[model samples]
Target: MIHIVFNEADIPVLQQAISLDESLQGEVVVIRDDYAVGPLDHTYAGEGREARLNWWREVLAGGDYEGKTDTGEVDDFKTVAELVGTLRRNPEETIWIWAAQNKHDVSGYYWLLHFMKEFQGRVFILYLNNLPFLSEKGQLFYPIWLHSIPPKEFLKAKKLARPITLSEFEVDPDEWIRLCQEKKLVRILEGGKKLSQHDADFYDIDLAKFITVDWQKASKIINQFQHKNKHTTGDAFLLWRLKKLISDGGFDTQGEIRNMKDFEIKLKSQHQAETA
Candidate 1:
């Protein structure tokens, strides 16, 4: 089954699309995690549960409401696992779509992550309003309340069952830089040329007089400039530099990164650059 993961920036729109497509109508289910209980039902209290029931009434009408929302408040890890297994083995087409409504609502991932491991079904993620560091491409499961990792990245990283670093997913660092450069936002480097993906990381990147070696050096430069110079400070620069430095796409618990497309892209792009 094919799954398309999207950010929660467009939930109402997504709900509309899911509603319109007969094939997709009943196939998709949304899961939400609870956060700080507000003066109202923000914390998924009895009222929050009832509120959620009402919200889904309009959203999931004509489809099964189930009248049940699984909050981590209860310990039902095994039940969740079983549900995932059943969904995956179901002959009917289906999509388990999760909406991380708030930044602190990351507890939802615990169960979903467990489910995905056992169930071989399509899974998609959506991150609604999130905090900084947790908004990396729509995932908010980082250390700072589930740091902002991309939803797909978070899913893959969870499957790997390890802490994620930038290098874990970024195979084509130079290619990524090129994409940034094409956008003409790469200025932290003088003549920053591409390098093999292995060279980009938090440490062990030798410039050797090249413009910019990899993301590792770029972050050091940015942080140094801010710490030592104090002349440059901005979210844009930090993000750009961080994105550049953290493109290593390193290994997993198996001690290997086997995604060929990411590595292959670098060589293919480099060859094209050389020929052109």
Candidate 2:
């Protein structure tokens, strides 16, 4: 069996889970790209892939991830092709796709569905949507990301697996195609397998809310925003947007903007003078 996950952070925990239960043992492959953001035009091959890579180059320019775009790290198409090759060679091999209740995971799942149609019964899904699990403190809570769940909790999650039905194989691919056609910069999870599209600046308002007139490190503002908001894109994406906000003159900045810790950001307002 082969295990597929969207997030890199979830990899270690999943490996631990496989260690605990040998029955769950399989190679965990990650689709590194965050499908929730960026252009999806012809993403699978040819000009579309180049366009998407160009967009990523633009987004990562002048940031920490700059020049890291072509490192062959974020190739979902190659990953899927390799998986298909493996499946074709090993007829008995099965695939388990694990997804949590979040836009990132769900969007990744959507992007993968189209390619898994040929593998029908061999493809299984374990969606942890609205499912409650015990934390280390023994309190019950729902997890938004698979990495958020303890490794032991995955034993219970594995039981939720079921084959991707024929209807879903047919319909879900259409849904993904439709989403790609829309080509929205952002995708948000509305509910069970449903996603809503938004503009690139969708999270700008929330990100700005964490900023104040007082100068604070960019890292602090980003950390605070992530802690306060339930739904968040990754830090790299947020930082890209933050730079956009800065360029738009909605906020003021100090120091270099390449790395989060290298810069300070504040609201665009005058400071009050202290009385002697």
Candidate 3:
């Protein structure tokens, strides 16, 4: 079962996700951030954060629901946990929600939860940045956790670590290497259209270039080639390399994977995490 959470802006995206999950029977919850915590009715005296937190705690104790938190404004998480618990007796089956702040990126909110310990490790995060219902176009990005892994709310690194892999469906590694070796600026083998490696190359370099660049152009070409050729470009071999990297503690170059490793160790020592 999938629990969906969303604000007004996320209505369309959330609706789409629900529609796609037609086979998965589940519940959908909505939180009007503008009116949460009895904002207009005036539930608590100082009932802003404190009231919200209290609501969450009560919800957590209730343990009835599972779904996304709508902007984490009201006792959203608490309520979500309550329901998620009913569906998931074993912690493994549980799903929790934490709504994120809009704009820029999720890093800020990610750190906020991490440092504040806002999560209890039982729920998952469904990012709503991409939701068209969002005032900001809500593009429907996938779920994201910071460097924080499962089952805890703690910050890892300012620059979070995430996994990335090249899909070899179009261009094989050998072909890419060969193109690079040949110094070819343009190659168009797949993707239903030809691509120019570079009709032009940028001379100026910026800080974001190195960090954000995925070399997608190169990877996609190879993936496309593989598809057109009706052949597999060795996903099994790549998975092996990925395993080795995880073992070696590969992560963002920000040097923060160490903290993630530390938290992982601590969690392991305290209780045996099923996935560990």
Measured by lDDT, the strongest candidate is: 2
Question: What's the distance in Å from true for residue 42, model 3?
Answer: 18
Show the lowest summed lDDT stretch of 10 residues, model 3: 199-208
Better of 1 and 2 by lDDT: 2
Q: Please count the clashing residue pairs in each candidate, in the order shown.
A: 16, 0, 31
lDDT of 1 by residue, 1-276 (tens): 222222233244444544554434443233432211111223224664456445433322222222233333332334444455656677554434343333223333322443353333344434332323334445444322222343333434322222222342243333433332232211221111221111122122322111232322333444455454412323222333333433443211121112211121111234444664
TM-scores of the models, in the order given: 0.25, 0.95, 0.25
Q: Return the lDDT, model 2, position 38.
A: 93
Q: Which sections of candidate 1 miss by over 4 Å?
A: 1-15, 27-82, 91-94, 126-276
* lDDT for 242 (candidate 1): 36
Tens digits of per-residue lDDT, candidate 2, 72-151, equal 87778889999999999999999999999999999999999888989999999999999999987889999988998999
- Provide the clash count, candidate 3: 31
